[model samples]
Target: MKNLYDLVVIGSGPGGYVSAIRASQLGLRTAIIEKYQELGGTCLNVGCIPSKSLLDSSKYFSLAKNNYSSHGIFFEKLFFDFKKMMDRKNEVVKNINNGVKYLMKKNKIDVYQGIGSFKTKNILFLKDIKSLKEKKEIQFQYCIISTGSKPSCFPHLNFHLENRILSSTEALHLKEIPKKLIIIGGGIIGLELGSIFNRLGSKIIILEPMEKIISNMDDSLSHEMQKILEKSSIQIETSLSVSNIFKENHEQISVFAKYHNGKEVKFIGDYCLLSIGRIPYTKNLELENIKIQKNKKGFIHVNDDLQTSVKNIYAIGDVIGGKMLAHKAEEEGLYVVEHIVGKKPNKLNYDLIPSIIYTYPEVASVGRSENEIKKDKIEYNIGIFPMKILARARTSGCTDGFLKMISHKKTDEILGVHIIGDHASDMIMEASIAMEFRSSSEDIYRICHPHPTLSESFKEAALLNFENRSIHM
Candidate 1:
């Protein structure tokens, strides 16, 4: 007799592990498989968690060195230990890993430490992660593939992971911060990681092929963030494409690129950090065996219900190609499990999902950007508030960003919210909740926000939307 399950979720990431736990809660026998020995996928292991940990540490160091004197606090000699910072980050990650293990045990979900492959629509084959040998076959009623993604690299910049070259993964675990760091992409990962070393006293240079960093957000955000990065002494070169990388010496790397103005550009650095992006990682799952339909970019195809060509098999997270946020994956996991138990869950709202960049002053948004509204030729009202005007922001000594709101001109319903200020990631949730209930700008303005807090910016922007102005702004 073979082991059986009502659900088998592959990857054990935010999507996979969450779905397996939800399945168990619904009284379904569940199992989860992961290729990595430690759980939490890239988000926990090497991506979000570790990166944010370093971001936090670097932020504190930056504040003590730069802003502490403004608050009348002086130190003889302030210093940071890179090794100690990394050790603490590892501690935070290990604790979360234990928490995930506890959840799996609490739900009685069997966890297999190996890669999962499809044997049939109703059967799964597990392979040893190290040896790549088939370990077992399990019968399952349904399966979910949530194996996330890997860092994307360009052909010219590609090299073996070693001392000089690095992906975002290797960037996190570098033994020493490079003196001159040249980053090739200016997206979320690039900006966040660039800030980390820039604050650590590195001469940072960022080369972005696009016109702006975090270009997917509102143009205002892109412009404001660029100013902030430049204020921190990080060089940002936009509209430039890197053509080649050459090792000038043992520790010197030269990068060659073409500027949008048709001029050749060259840069020399101690290390080159590649933060281009990531792609779905499913090449080895033998998805071909199941004949799963993937688009041109290799993301698995799924219907509205997240079901593949075979209805019993579902796909979610980065593997399925929507917004690649961890929270997005978690929500989809919950929805799919509820769906499996004959419960009709609410549809996943990709638009309302908040996207965040965890820099010193975070960037977060939900619903739509002004660019999207303009493209559709919608009548909209806009409200913009600078963080410098807020009392809380001034007191905090970090007033380098702003919050903008967009609402329907006639109906007054809030269409989108963009924030780049203190606690923007946490603050955006209020907008998310409001948008979830279809709250109007006037509706948000009516709600009482506490005095001398960062959240007041949201309400002020809301007031500016319909009232033509705000008391503070």
Candidate 2:
């Protein structure tokens, strides 16, 4: 009984730690298990936090090297120290790691640094991460698994850090900026990492097997973003299926691919980054001991309440595989915690959870995409306003994208909002809030948005959506 807890959460990523904290707050004796030495998992350690830190640092360096001159700001010479940027990124991650540890202590949740394996529906054994020796046994009335995901690679390719076939994790820790980087797959991970290196003076070539990069998003977004990235001198090749990747020598890598029409091409670069996708990390949990059910994709199966086949156990975050966004995982963590406490929290609106890509001009969308609405066969009206027309855009010199609003033709209710522009990541929350309340296009149009702000574009788009007219254009 000494090791018994009301709840035991496995994995200390955003989802796991957050659920543990909430459980403690709800007066449950809780504990969390982490296999890594550090507390925060991939998101804080590598995926979101480190990536954004580098992104911001690289963006500043780029502005000084290219854009400041047009604003009457000129420097005799502009230079950046790549080492310092990486140092700052590491420091940021370290601070957040310590912060998570402090939260565990503050909340009085027992922290176990080991791999947790199920022994029964109500019992788990913690083993030393490296030795695989059982260290302790723990019991819990309920359990939540949030062991996230890892970058996936092709079946034939073996990733060795020395050979420079990089995943996003390896790409983040490069000692030097590559002279040329070849990126396979142009989803959020590939494009984001490519943008970072490109801004830092690396020649970037992106090969996407699909017809468009960011293919899951709105078609308009794909078209506009491709144009923007290409204009920035990043080479993008679509409809190419990579056949093989091999090291030509110690310093160079080669990628061989074929086009849809069967034309073969080869690309050589200093490094090849594989960003095809990620797989749910459900390894070493020994789920078979307890007969936990998982789908064919290795993601644990959970019902409407996020309950596993064994009702007392639940799974959240990338292990269960939905959006795979940190925020989405965090929300699911909260939902599971509140559900356990009988708080009866509102069910998550999966459709309204926003998706964001943090390229130079960010892309974000919430609610249904235009294509999804079309697939549903719903009658809808569309309104689009370019960001360039806004005075705020001209003032800031960020005039490359637009805001598009889709609404029901009959009821006038806003259905989806898509944007590609400055602050698109932050700007998307407005649309999410509007759609969450089932607000109409006229409602957003009538709301007063401050002048000389990027958000006014939202109002203009809403006006155009409902009335088919815009005040600015």
Q: Please report, in order, the local distance difference test score of every candidate based on alpha carbons.
A: 0.91, 0.94
Worst 10 residues of 1 by lDDT: 154-163
Regions of model 1 farther than 4 Å from truth: 156-163
Off by over 4 Å in 2: none
Question: Residue-wise lDDT of candidate 1 within 11-37, one digit each (tens)?
Answer: 988888899888999999999998888
Q: Could you estimate the TM-score for every candidate?
A: 0.98, 0.99
What C-alpha lDDT does candidate 2 achieve relative to the native structure?
0.94
- Backbone clash count, each prediction separately: 0, 0
TM-score of 2: 0.99
